[model samples]
Target: MFGDGEHDDGPRVHQQRSEGPGGQSAQQHQTHLDSIFMLLEENIVTFVKNELKKIQTVLTSDYPECLESQREDEEVLDGEDEEQRSSREAFLNISLHFLRSMKQEELAERLQSSKSI
Candidate 1:
């Protein structure tokens, strides 16, 4: 903690940076938390774009399956830390309505049923 209405996130953030390459700031790390959904959504869009060229009917269920096999930091989600996995699940839960609002009802439903998506 600090004065002047400022605060410190403390040593975990500091330790994360220590484990990585030099000079990576805490805000750089915060980006991973903030961009999880956006990054996942971008990956979905890429899959859809590729699938469109190969076939007509793209099954929404395929996304979550494909997504489960995807990786971060050169490691698959199966190897992900608890914090990251929990963050991802929480984000998916929060984004379900957004998924439906975007006309992705089937995708939303599939993710809702899956523990990891």
Candidate 2:
């Protein structure tokens, strides 16, 4: 079917029929399979998009919490002393690390769910 110069933008299947008491033509069976595959693909795409939206929502909601916590930590380290600067840097690093871990976990869960599908 490749390079047939037909410019058909559809699924292609081999046309080989099986003879049986109640059987469908090879073309008919292939068409049915193609339809089923196309439907399945669309469903998968929709599911992934939905999952991504959920992830986005979760991230958006979590953002304010992150910012608030950072602000609180900074308030606690109000002094410009060396110890306070060091503590602030440490807190920022830890916060960044925690956020990265949370994002990684979310992505891993998403991938696991997609694999299940």
Candidate 3:
């Protein structure tokens, strides 16, 4: 999913910052991660709000319960917001992958401490 014009340069291009003292604690770290996910969902919701206006125009007066049934005559839009969920998953995956890759032993120790909770 990297888009056009996207570049990582190199892993060393950007130094990862250690989370603050609050994130050092198990409960606080979970809370920090939750907050990040919440923000990402909020942003996705905002995007959906904008997109909905365009979808409404395309959907016109008639709406169908089933997407498959509508596909032949109308544009089938996903009623359930899946983009937000995918965005959150992508964010978490990237964060965890980076932590596990470069900081291997350190990340393992931290995750082990938090796993019980």
Candidate 4:
């Protein structure tokens, strides 16, 4: 009864290699996996852009004034608001504006690149 089944491991191995799922080969399965990876990468980049926009709206808002007032002694707001703070306030505001603008430009470039690809 067991004689035919125990003939050898060669044909069993060959059969396994030649069949997958309903019987697609290994190369066909790899193409599907590659496409899934590309789609996932695209989704992650989109999520980052949306989250950054939300944060940008909050940071550049008048909420900074209220937030700064609370941290007056901690130096967190040491030179943030111009009319209220010292001479350094204007420079700080300008510096923050430049940095934010640079970040936005970089984000735009990345989004454009992703779309182009």
Candidate 5:
């Protein structure tokens, strides 16, 4: 329905889009699986760092004058507020559930063991 050298960049292009839920392509699904798998293998150093930043902000904002002068040796979980702890726990469980849904029993078990600790 087009000239020899022309292309259809309208409905035809849209029709070729992924049928996967949330409009994710096959490659996207593959990348998601790979990412979760890597997270399982890497054991959450990144997650801990992120939690540290959040905890630091909350502590400094609440009692800056006291904490800012202390220079204390602190850990990420040392000042974890209830909400932050809950968020971290929820993420672990969500990841575990996703792994299980993908039939990754081994990874799910690993996550479960970690979560218990």
Candidate 6:
């Protein structure tokens, strides 16, 4: 009886249930999986938003000073090297993209698309 594909060393409840006629149906299993995926997506979105908020706070509060300090350091090297400057600019662009992706409208659109699937 335990030879069924769904039956194995899975969680004790699932393993036991899979051996019985009262086991969850495939539709129920798929729904449960979908809900789990939705919950994980929401958690990831929350984490990204919180981290972006922290970064935005830091940037707003200290960005100018940070830039000034970077400029001073760059002057010592006779202005920033081309490669280093480009790398910094690329990092900034990626950060901006993440921030935009977390915006309410963008998130709402993504949620809508996910729900339709």
**lDDT (C-alpha, whole model) for all candidates:** 0.56, 0.54, 0.52, 0.50, 0.62, 0.54
TM-score of each: 0.34, 0.39, 0.30, 0.37, 0.35, 0.35
Q: Tell me the deviation in Å of residue 72 in model 3.
A: 28
lDDT string, candidate 6, 11-58, tens digits: 687444332234776677778889999999998678557545433444
- Which candidate ranks first by lDDT, i.e. highest? 5
| RMSD in Å for all candidates | 15.1, 19.7, 24.6, 15.1, 13.9, 15.5
Measured by TM-score, how close is model 2 to the native structure?
0.39
The Cα error of candidate 1 at residue 101, in Å, is: 3.1
Q: State the lDDT at 112 in candidate 4.
A: 35
- TM-score between model 1 and native: 0.34
Give a tens-digit lDDT track for model 3, residues 1-117: 568879777777246545666547556787888999999999877865644443333333244543344353233333335875475345445545666788665653453343111
By TM-score, the better pick of 4 and 6 is: 4
- Give the Cα error of residue 28 in candidate 6, in Å: 0.9
State model 2's lDDT.
0.54
Stretches of candidate 6 off by over 4 Å are 1-23, 63-117
The parts of candidate 1 lying over 4 Å away from their true place are 1-75
Better of 1 and 5 by lDDT: 5
- Which is the better candidate, 2 or 3, if ranked by TM-score? 2
| Candidate 1 local lDDT, 1-117, one digit each (tens) | 466888766668535543323566667756765698789899877855543422211233256554433433225546868986676556555567677889988766766675435
lDDT of 4 by residue, 1-117 (tens): 566667544556645675455677877777777898999899856855643443343343346664443344336434446654443334334434665577866544443333111
How does residue 64 of candidate 2 score in lDDT?
Answer: 71
All candidates in order of lDDT, best leading: 5, 1, 2, 6, 3, 4
Clashing pairs in 2: none
Q: Cα deviation of 44 in candidate 6 (Å)?
A: 0.9
Displacement of the residue 18 alpha carbon in candidate 2, Å: 2.5
For residues 1-117, write the lDDT of model 5, one tens digit per residue: 676889856677656756565778978887888999998767666776764454344334446664543344345456879986797778666666777899988756754653222
